[model samples]
Target: MPQANGHANGHANGHVNGHVDGNAAPLPADLIDPRQVKLHDALHRLRKLEAAKDIDIPQLIVVGNQNSGKSSVLEALVGFEFPVDNGACTRFPTHYSLRRGEASTTAFIKPGPGRNEVEKACLEELSRSIRNPTSFHDLMRAVNAGLGKKVGMERTGDTGKGFCDDVLMIERRGPDLPQLSLVDLPGLFTASSGHQTDEDQETVQEMAETYVRNKGSMVMVIASAQEDIHCSSGIGLIQKLVRKDASLNERTIYVITKPDMAQSFASLKSVVDQFRFPRPAHFLRNQDSGRDRPRSLASRDAEEEKFFGSGEWVGVPQAQKGIAALRTALKEMLWGHTKNQLRRLIPAVQDMTEEAQRGYKRLEEAGRPDRRKFLVDVAQDFDRLIGNAVIGNYVNREFFSSFDDTSLEVRYKRLRSTARALNKRFATAVQEHGKTVVIGRPRPSGRPHGSAPPPAFLAAEIDRLYSYPEPESKCWADYETWVAGMVDDWRTGEPRGQASSMAYWALFEYQSRGWKRMAENHLKAVWMVIDRFIDLALAEVCPDDGVAEALRRRVMDTHVDKLRLAASTTLESLLSCHGRGNSGFYDSLDDPHTSRSRAQALISKIAELPSLDGGGSPRNAPAL
Candidate 1:
């Protein structure tokens, strides 16, 4: 075979004649035909690589109507006959690889997946039977057996008794054969017979479409010159596929068979002129007698020469007619296409190999136990969630944004701010609404105008305050009891005690109720933060339904409950201290009108009073 020979031009180095440009250098006499040999070998390697990777390799697909000279064209190209019959002779796809060598043929059947050992053994025996076949009939019998067909089964659709999609591969090598590889799919048909159902017809069409529709394939649509071009044949089907992918017209080749029998060339000429079918259409006479009658190689050649020399085809381009012309056209087309595909194929195969390696490495790592790494990952995720909850740096917007107009994370971040605002409101409610008497204001005309003793006035004001329940108080009984004690203390106070004790208890009780409500609200806000944190963490760390549920049950549920309880306890304790009277009550007395400077000296003694909870003296109370 012609070698690359350090030349940049592929056709220039090849021994193939007429394929190269006319001005290219001539070839040596000893060189093998590169068009036939080099191209075939390159394509063979590509097919092998594609099969190994389970990728789609480029192909030349043959499609035609039943008994439309499809088998004749293929047999003529391959320089041999395998099997052909009247109606739908080929049920499954048959791939032919032709080359120049000794006259020999080998066959192999690639049964599709799920075949048992028995079926494999049967296929192997069938292959052996085809190798030493005495006649084409023997080949047909082996093909039927390999496809799992019974001897008497009718050739129906793919749903027939022994229908399969597995390819029947045959490699034929002989002298003067053009190097070519082609797949002959099942012929297209319109109506179904008693044996072939509508399902069968569809199956056959589907199998044909599978090959012709491949973008990487060069589709050869065969139509008998005697038949209507617009009929529901393989040509029409090819046209449909070409329409869907306009680029296919550049790769598609139309082959007109049985041209000698065509009654009128006017319709065919119009089709070619209008570009109805993709050209160049090669017209050939493959069969002179019936389909079953075999023609000798010399006789076939003589007939082709006679047809071309006749007056009917005088003006037709020599390159656009005859089987020999078609063979040359195919070789040239395959060479150019194969070169382009190979250029692209190398990088694609490399990328696929690298990707597969990465996937394998990942799978290998997954097979090993790495609990330490897993735990570290979980810890990292937990820390991230805590950070997000505290600082509102959430990643998934859907987790919060989709739940409501405002996200849960945003609300969680606002918890502290919301609590502070409520606390301020609580203080304002205490300052404006909690006071029963204005220190500098006089009594109204209809009310008791005369001032009683300071102790008696304080007791009457406490009664009025406790009679109407404060809107914020949760514990009314405790408040009433505390008020009664304050009144009693004021009544029993020493003479100078009036200023220090004046209405302080009523103000203290009112402020305590406001603080209690604020504390409860703050506790609820903290609970909401924890709840949203659990939701955010689960969504991030355990998005799977099962994993999230397990985490919620095993970890989040108990953990959040404990957090809620602890926060509730802290807030409740703070509120409870406010609810009971504090020693700081005397510190709130700032009135300078009374003669209680000496009583202020006694205020320090009352400031050290123990709390009602029996805990140590209360810490300095929060500012009202």
Candidate 2:
């Protein structure tokens, strides 16, 4: 291995044949073989850092379905429960340390569009969409109204349709162990059962999958034994993970929850036998236990200690035969043959003396005239590399600009038109299929033959439609909610909460009558927007050429690695915006409005076409 010699300045001291000499001059590019030169330099640097050992503490990522006792199990193991309320406790992946006394840092990992990021983007969108230049309060009202309508909310609130509110990270340090770290991820399915709850469920599922796919850390999946654990949605998640890189199997652990829910000791045995998962563990907790009454760290530790025992001992028996048996099974799992059954790979350290000696002599005399020609050729490679980079960048930029100025607009318009056509097609499709979207209002035995409604029955039918039986006032209320939320843009801010009101009425109307058509149209519009956004994004993120390629070559070449480091530092931030997980202008919805802010705002508001619920004023209604 090569080492960093006294000639600290790699460039000034100039390496000869890949070795840096304070007194020696750099060999001409024509004299050295680039391959040997590169290898020699790399070897020298490897020698310098060879003495340092990098140890990364393995992080255990714990996640599962909502209320599947995910947080409970983590709190039980890590010796503390994070803050739990009626709402979710963990919104994003957070790191927790077992190292005590020292302050544990709380780190949150969230998906794209964080709060500040989303807020800025939304504000920008609102500013652009709303035509009127109003006070901050009025602007907020319009924004709130837009958002409320989009999400079908009764009134506008502080939040919008973005999921930034769902992500958070928390870290805690423990005194006893410094090496162990745990990551708590948000529950898979949400506990909330609302109209958009399914969407939330899908989002959470995607988030979990993305986390799992990117997880360099180990994983512990907690599940309830009582739930139909083998359903497609449940098993699909597991199957997808098992198919990831081979290392996953070794790092994964399955935990069955709610052992206390079992009927008897025999049944518990039967349950464990049925799952047949290797080294599976079970936890017993009351089904109705309030999340607020979390056990203290010490108490949970004691309980864990009792069940699995310490690293050394086995748990004792108790009068509750089932509990004792479960503990015994768990202990066996932790320390007995079951654990040892899992295959593990530990690499054997090699003895370097013999091989180093054999390679050293050849490596020493490797820099002859023939090698020099090779080295020159290698250096020459940098020129072509840089050339390609320049070309790639130029082409990418041109394409990006083209997309932005022309291609993107064309594609967006096409997609928009397609989507709208599809929506219209769906309506035609429904009618062609002879599907009458009936208004579920009280009707006589049948419609009398000569009594015809108006030609503009679309709006009137929606107004009279009632999916559920209710009084006239309630029907009107539902209508208002429908009308207001329809066409409402939820990305805007509402200073005075009027946005919420507008959304309430708009969404109700939008969701009613011709819903299939509406959905088809909306989805088409969203797809078009996303597609254009993605195309423009791809264009703007052109690869940097000269420096990037130069650095790549240097890193590939010899002992002094200044080029690679310099190049990396130079390009990291610049290219970061183009990476796979990068966000675009839509994500930056709150950015300040640039051009036509008022027009954008006005267009967005007019697009919403807010309606009144029950065709009555909210100001006149008494509090429910």
Candidate 3:
């Protein structure tokens, strides 16, 4: 059996050279014990190979939902009692690699994805202090300790982390251990409870998904015999995954744990038959007596042999009975998977060679050609890059490869994505401050803003609009005082009843004119983002400063100015137009960019006016 090595995006333990030939000797086609030191050396070497992620490495990943007898099966397989019975459960992934040698157990921790250098170093240091684990219980404690002790982090209440994706790797060289290794993942959870949240459940689910999705990973899905098939989330996951890739059916194995605890053999068969278990499921009852005392592997095998020989399991083949047999079955499965990996070795090397040769040709090119032709190429490249950015295409691997978020090079390269984010923020700003007036009753005490952003977009503008302090002529005071003067201008000699009726329309028009001003501000803001994006795009497209500047001034600047002017002209026409041709609907907005909440708030306050819903010459305003 080979030891499984850890590899993250850009980190690895070591590198593998050409073909299947490297520091590791060629593995024989015949079945080998999975716990051998040589197999692990080969796997660890393969994991560090250049472009190794493109190749699927053989592994047995154990997965199940929380409290689904997942921990029990792992304990039974290793014959080392886990501390799960004492409130400690598998919170993070733990990968165990076993081999035969002078009895020694050493362990380490692999940082989870996205941990910074400082945190990774802290985890690595945690491993250095832990040279030996006297038992599996102590090994589990060390793992939890490493996971909980994040660098520069402090907390209270619980001593351990809620759930983490960080991996704990263990290597055991002992005279008594079996010849095998398996990856035990954090169990999937059904719902949020206790310290775990819905987010935590999702995290664990995704982690299990990552393992089972791997083509070379032989999944040991532990399904509880006592629970309904539908209730077991792991069964559901396997079902969906197998549907997507039918070949996953070949690698997946479902094992029913706690066969003795089921209501009856018939009831247990009902749970087992619900799912097409990929391969025939092996049913076994893990002994509960281990809880009071540690159970050795040899005793477990003897007890299982007697238990199966006298019961309904008597007819079951030796290949599908007990944890000891399952371990052998898994090792044989690995042997076949390894041979499959070797069959693709030569072709993989050929592809790598061709890709490298092409890369070399690109690197060797140098010197310049015709300046005009160069400029033309730059312009075409610029157009293509912009087109892709507009359409959200990232096919060009040269510049659009790395997504280092802090780099402006990466940020501006994604033109459409950047625009979408800005557009969302722009809409948010309009929703908050575009009204220029908030005419609702004062908010209730202790109530906070709900989902809506604060009026920070145009704070000064809103303040100036409401700055009216005159006795009988404030905009905030009600439409009456402001409309009183305007009412006389529109209908000087008309009856007071009719004059008051015209006041609502007058107030509506007065407030509507400000829409044009806000529209202009938003327009400028949009063009500003696009304009900055163009500059960044040009720099990337044409490395020559002179060529880039010439294009910016001659082509980009002129087209931008023309486009901006045309947009401004169109906006003017839309605002001023009022005729039969206008259906008053635009796809961009449900109600012409007017924030509906603000509009309703305004209507509620003004509904009390004598000219609106009041008894004195009550009249309706223009259609909103």
Stretches of candidate 2 exceeding 4 Å from the true structure? 1-58, 87-90, 97-101, 104-167, 190-192, 225-236, 243-247, 284-295, 301-405, 408-624
Error of 2 at 400 (Å): 10
Q: Would you list the C-alpha lDDT of every candidate in the order shown?
A: 0.57, 0.39, 0.60
1-624 per-residue lDDT for model 1 (tens digits) = 211111011111211121222322121111224744665566566666533445455668988877677876765665544365434357777887665666666677766454433344346556666664444545655687556542213353444443456677877655555566788887788888765668768878888887777766788888876666667387678677766888778777888876665666666667556655555778877654443134454456567778877876877888888766787777666666666666777777788779769766765776646545654676577666666545544454543343344533554433334334334443333433343332333322331222222122123322322223223333556666766676666563545535334445445665445455444543443343455555656666654454466667687777765765686688778767755546254333332223245476656555588878887666764221
RMSD of 1: 31.5
Find the candidate with the highest TM-score and give its number: 3
Positional deviation of 476 in candidate 1, in angstroms? Answer: 99
- Show the lowest summed lDDT stretch of 10 residues, model 1: 3-12
Cα-based TM-score, every candidate? 0.48, 0.38, 0.51
Better of 1 and 3 by TM-score: 3
Q: What lDDT is obtained when candidate 1 is compared to the true structure?
A: 0.57
Residue-level lDDT for 621 in candidate 1: 41
Output the better candidate (2/3) by TM-score. Answer: 3
User: Which candidate would rank higher by lDDT, 1 or 3?
Assistant: 3
Instruction: Estimate the TM-score for candidate 1.
Output: 0.48
Descending-TM-score candidate ranking: 3, 1, 2
